[model samples]
Target chain A: MIIDINAFLGHYPFRRLPHNSARTMIELMDAHGIDSAVVSSLHSVFYRDAHRGNEDLFLETKDFGSRFVRVATVNPKYVSWRRDLDEAMDRWKMKAVTLFPAHHGYLLSDVECQQAIEEIVRRDIPLVLTQRLEDRRQRHHWDAAEDLEFKSVLELVRQHTKLRLALVNWIGLDGKRMAEAGLQGRCLIDFARLHVLLNKDVDKLISSLGITSIAFGTHMPFDYVGPSLVKLANLESNPAIDYPAVSWRNAARFFGLEGGD
Target chain B: MRKIDVHNHVFDAVDQPGANWARVESMIEAAEWLGIETLCCSRPITGGAMAEIAEVRRANDAVLATMQRYPDRVRGFCFIQPGNGRLAIDEMQRCFDQGMIGVKLYNQFKYADPMVYPIAEKCIELRIPLLGHSAHLTDARSIAAQPMTSDSLEFCKLATRFPELILILGHINGGGDWEWAIKGLRECENVYLDTSGSVLENDTIEMCVRELGVKRILFATDQTMEGCVGKILSAQLSSEQREDIFWKNAHAIFARRTS
Candidate 1:
């Protein structure tokens, strides 16, 4: 199945998002032949109260059912995170949790983050970390969100043993650092930002970082799905890459979808 | 419908040991999904912060070789550094003689700088477009690195100076403020923006169409092939408008050679 591991719903402040609604998003996915998308709310990344965005995310995708793998955006800094996260997982069926440490103003090292990480680990749910959801350089003038640093992820991997960390957007660029951080099995990455055809980064990365580490993502609605599809086209040509693995198998495993791995 | 990629690059992969049509074919094959019919390719100087005249010549030579090798598919864009002064103009002439369709400028000099005027004049005289490497950088550090980087603002400035110049501000989504870049480009009828670069902001292509009209926008990848192709494909443009941006506009620029 073609799955977009990183997708979103909700209005982006900078640009008019035509495909933000569930029906429009599905139409876009069908137009692109994407079978499923792991979706969270875009406002969740910036909202002061994480549950507010999660509530919106659940509301948006509730009609589509499992066609959208609802991922709750959790701010460990928020006091009622534990209860809200449980409600999102149990009540809303948000199968995965995404953390915007850079946006929410907490490092993976923070005490609250560690607590949330432990709880997520206990539940055996994947914790996805998004970096630079919007290109920081192109962010709206007043938006102060910074790109999540690579080292912060390294620290997360180094510290949390069972954390199934899924890195998204440009954060997944440095395969070398990821290889160094030992981010193969437990950690997964989306390929929206990885350059395959133009630069040899993806080829070199797959050789070293292993093919299973990468999965399909387009940063859709917020961005276009075209680039990831292009990257996928290039990857499919490489005999070394297992097309199915990057296409959907690894993503299924990462996001706890059926038929994964 | 034919799609022309007006801004793309060829690395030294062709010069690598035992390099064959396979490398070029792979690029074309990769773009088969997007059906990229023609690629206007250039190899800008890779090693240095600024390119010298010799380096500029070598880059153009690389472009010439690609164009020759894939004559039907590849169109050469002569990459030059205006700082090379007389030699740069001469190099542009040499590439034009070799059938290069346009001039590709890196951050070696600003588009509005006096040094670039001679090259702009050369492009105008030859009826070839001058595609400037551009970005509207906001941060201080990035600005520090590519200080000579031209943007749509500078392209407009240059177009104002040379009204007939077919000036292309390369990669609106390349980086920095695209809203700023696209807005700045509206008044300069002579300046066109290529759809390339990595960032595929939703409505960016539509915004360009809204502001600049379909005739002036060019389809380009700048090596970020999929993103750009995707941007245009997913845009709120009709098939005819898509064809116009993807092929006709580039066809016009490449066909405009006088001598």
Candidate 2:
């Protein structure tokens, strides 16, 4: 069974997604052999108060049961974010929380963000940070959502060594640098945007940074899932590497959902 | 269907590690995994950016060597810096004489620059396609690093000036206004948009097929084979159209080369 760590539901304001609804998303996943997915709401990216978006995501995935895990969004820019996060964890039972620093106009170093990270760590819930939602070149002509500063995120991760942070949509030199900066076991990287792994460097990356911290994530609806699947297939062909660990085991262990299925 | 990747780089750069013969072999394995039959490889622009004319020649020679090694699986494109002027033209001839299939113009000079005309004319004379790197950004600050970056409009202008030259405007999906870039090349019959670049947005390939028919679009991975295949598969095109973009068009275009 495959567990996709980065999937989204709801409309993307920039371009129309082929499968934006939960039903279509599930159908898409099933067609692609995805057993379960940790999904967030695209609405939360643009919303001023991300709580409403989180509530929408909760309602969307509530009926899907374990097949679809809800990942709530909390914008530290809002003053009542801590309450929203608590409600998401306690009431909605969200297993993860995602942060859009670029869209929400804040840095990972912000005090509110730090407090939220601490709260999430205290609750043992994973924190997923989307480094970028859309490709910088493809952003709307007027949309000014810059990429989240990698230095700031690295600094934050350094401070919170035990924090379970999953950096999503980061690839190439930056991703490699982050991994090389002693983030191998400390932080997890979503494979949805690691295009370089599709090349000959897959084995090199695996050797340098073991497969434990890498997780399967297909930024579905925003990005096609086929590429990640291709990367997984390539990894599976190699007998030396543990493809299952990256496919689902790592994510399963990270979310503490191991042995449930 | 058979596939020919028209925009693949095969070189080890100073900054990007693991770019060696073993790496290219792994890339070829990955491409073969997806049923790609041939990769028309060229040295990456980053490799030629800091090198002297002799180094550039050595880089092209390395590409030729890889082609010779792979024979059926790999084809070499002579990468030239138009700024080298007469020496660039001579190097193109030298590589062509040594079995290089086509010309790959990097971002050393704009597609619209007069310096590129001689190279375009050389490609036309050699009956080879010129694969020029094209992006859509107009912001001076963004392109300050690679000042020679050309947009599709510049390609259109270049095509108009050299009607006989077959200009393959590469990387339509490389983080620029691709819609405008694709549309700008609508009337230029000799210009083809390659499906390369890193970002593969939904409907991008289909949109390119819609604006410029499948005959004018060539499948390319830019050395990112898996992602490129995903982009092509995600496109809502029929089997015939897929075949055309995947290999037929590339075969038809590159077949005319004297080499």
TM-score for every candidate vs. truth? 0.90, 0.89
TM-score of the first chain alone, every candidate: 0.94, 0.92
Candidate 2 at residue A110, lDDT?
85
Deviation in angstroms for A23 in model 1? Answer: 3.4
Docking outcome class, model 1: medium
> lDDT by residue for model 2 over B204-244, one digit each (tens)?
78788888888999999886688888778756689999999
What value does the lDDT take at residue B174 in candidate 2?
69
Tell how far residue A180 is off in model 2, in angstroms.
9.3
What docking tier does model 2 reach?
A: acceptable
Candidate 1 chain B weakest lDDT stretch, 10 residues = B13-22
Model 1 TM-score on a 0 to 1 scale:
0.90
Q: Pick by DockQ: which candidate is best?
A: 1
In model 1, the number of clashes is: 0
lDDT (0-100) at residue B16 of candidate 2? 29
Q: What's the lDDT for residue A129 in model 1?
A: 77
A236: Cα error in model 1, Å: 5.5
